[model samples]
Target: MNTTHRTIVSRRARPAKEPLSQEVIVKQAFLLLREEGISGLTMRKVAKTLDTGASSLYVYVKDLQELSSYVLDYALASVKLPDSDSEEWKNNLFAALISYQQVLYKDPGVAELALTTMPLGPHSLALSEYLLKQLAASGMQAASAAWGLDLLLMHVTSSAFEHVSWAKNEKRSFTLMKEAYLSADASQFPFIHSHKNELFSGDASNNERFLWGMEVILQGILKQDQ
Candidate 1:
């Protein structure tokens, strides 16, 4: 009468993990950048987010800087380039560059990376090629198009990078800057005194400033074409 009883155990199958590669690592790094921003994208942090060891990340990237750089390149892949006609090419190019700036602004660390790093990754190269093509079609000569890439990127990245830095600094004190302007011996600085409201008008209106700059550059480009 020693009838036996059996116990059944149930288990849920786990999902297969994505295979690890440089691309995979960079993808995770991008998520970290979006979540915690540039400073939060340390190697250890990214590793933890990816559920892997910090050492494992080295298999893909050389170091934390390289990892951040990789994240920039990875993010760049999302930028879609259109192949519209050269007609209205100046405006088309302006719109494209604006898209590029918006992409960097959305991802804080990227503008600095784009500015400092050479065009290496696939997306960066594609962007460069697209800009060059558009510039040529927009009536830029060989030299103008060649330097135009540098000019456009330099201006956009510098502006975007400064804004990113300003954004991240919780202790950012514009008080002194504003004070200086206000105190600028109004006798000599008639314009600053008169336009104080316009000058100190805060961050919410940056789009106008950005547009003004792009418009000036576009005007210069148009004159070159002429």
Candidate 2:
């Protein structure tokens, strides 16, 4: 039987039998996540993987959400944020964002967790503070900086996760999208048809697109200052 379908009892009634630590639980959870992705990382599944009852896991982890928080915290703690004190705030901001996205790519679904819950993990808070500091020093108002942080997180997480979804689903989405774009009615989408090449042109790297998007955001922020 698949491990997921195997019958497992909760430890609430039975005494805990596993001699594992929270560290071990977190480590094994990471493996499960890497092997099965988010949907496969569950408290019950983790207990089965660890050869313990589902209730035993509660001693180390409250729920799947808390388990995810632990893993995300452990992952973020290892990343080195770009220097947050640079006078060139725009450069610093974009570099930090790129680094953040790359880190998210290291383990899929962690970015979505961060984006939705905005967890107060120590490392997450540190990055948030760094971004706020850089934005504030760039002469952005408190309210604007607050919203700006949310905007950047939403953009990076959504964009990177979309890439992950495409990879996971084995979707040749862009090629199909290009075909549709190029085949659209010429009279209705004259400009889109004309610039189809430029619009669809990319060498499978999001770096240039990301940089351009950041530049546009920075320009808008600068306008707010003026």
Candidate 3:
């Protein structure tokens, strides 16, 4: 007769699980967002990742929405900001926003969160404060600064989303659209036919186009203040 023997590991010998806390829960959720994207981030998944019951997560987070806000804010912690007293305030502002865009560009889930969730956390507040201060230094009125901040953030978020979407195998759709635009009937769409090359001039991989758009928006805001 053949017999099988196995060693049983004692629970006491196992490593202790990390203590549950709001920060831990949020970090786990952020991990899920990076690994499995926005769709995979949930209380149940975060609880599973932490080796705990989903109900336990409720003690730390109110709901998925609240947790998403926390996760978004957590991800924003990596964004680099320039010195407050930098002489090149405009360039500094642009650099800060570009840093923010690069952060979102790294993960499609983050871009989605930036567009859909308004994170009311310290990191989010810091980014907003930094941008507002930069805008103020440029002689922007309070109203313009506030509204321009929204527009600037929206542009970066949307641009990141579009770039990520294209990178994630959506290029076929873009290609087909470009072909359709380029092949438009000259008699029907004269302008599109004439400017087809310029229409698709800059691809998403180029930062020059993004910077140009930023310049246009900044110029508009500055002019509005005048």
RMSD, every candidate, angstroms = 4.6, 7.4, 1.8
Positional deviation of residue 39's Cα in model 1 after best superposition, in angstroms: 1.7
TM-score of each: 0.77, 0.79, 0.94
Best by lDDT: 3
- Decreasing lDDT order of the candidates: 3, 1, 2
| Tens-digit lDDT string for candidate 1 (96-210) | 7777888888877676667665534788777888888888886668888887778887778888887777787733366677788878877899999999888856465657777
Q: lDDT of each prediction vs. the true structure?
A: 0.76, 0.76, 0.91
What candidate 3 gets wrong by more than 4 Å, as runs, is 1-6, 203-206
Off by over 4 Å in 1: 1-16, 115-119, 168-172, 188-206, 221-226
lDDT of 2 by residue, 134-226 (tens): 888888788888877877877788877876777766477766977899888889999988887888565557577766666777677668766
Residue-level lDDT of model 3, residues 1-226, one tens digit each, is 7578879999999999999999999988888899988888988889998999999999978899999999999999999999886467798899899999999999889998998998969999999999999998887799999999999999999999988888887999999999999999999999999999999887656697898899999999999889
* Candidate number that wins on TM-score, 1 or 3: 3
> Which candidate number would show the highest TM-score if scored against the true structure?
3
Task: Name the lDDT of candidate 2.
Answer: 0.76
Q: Is candidate 1 or candidate 2 better by TM-score?
A: 2
- C-alpha RMSD in Å of predicted model 1 compared with the true structure: 4.6
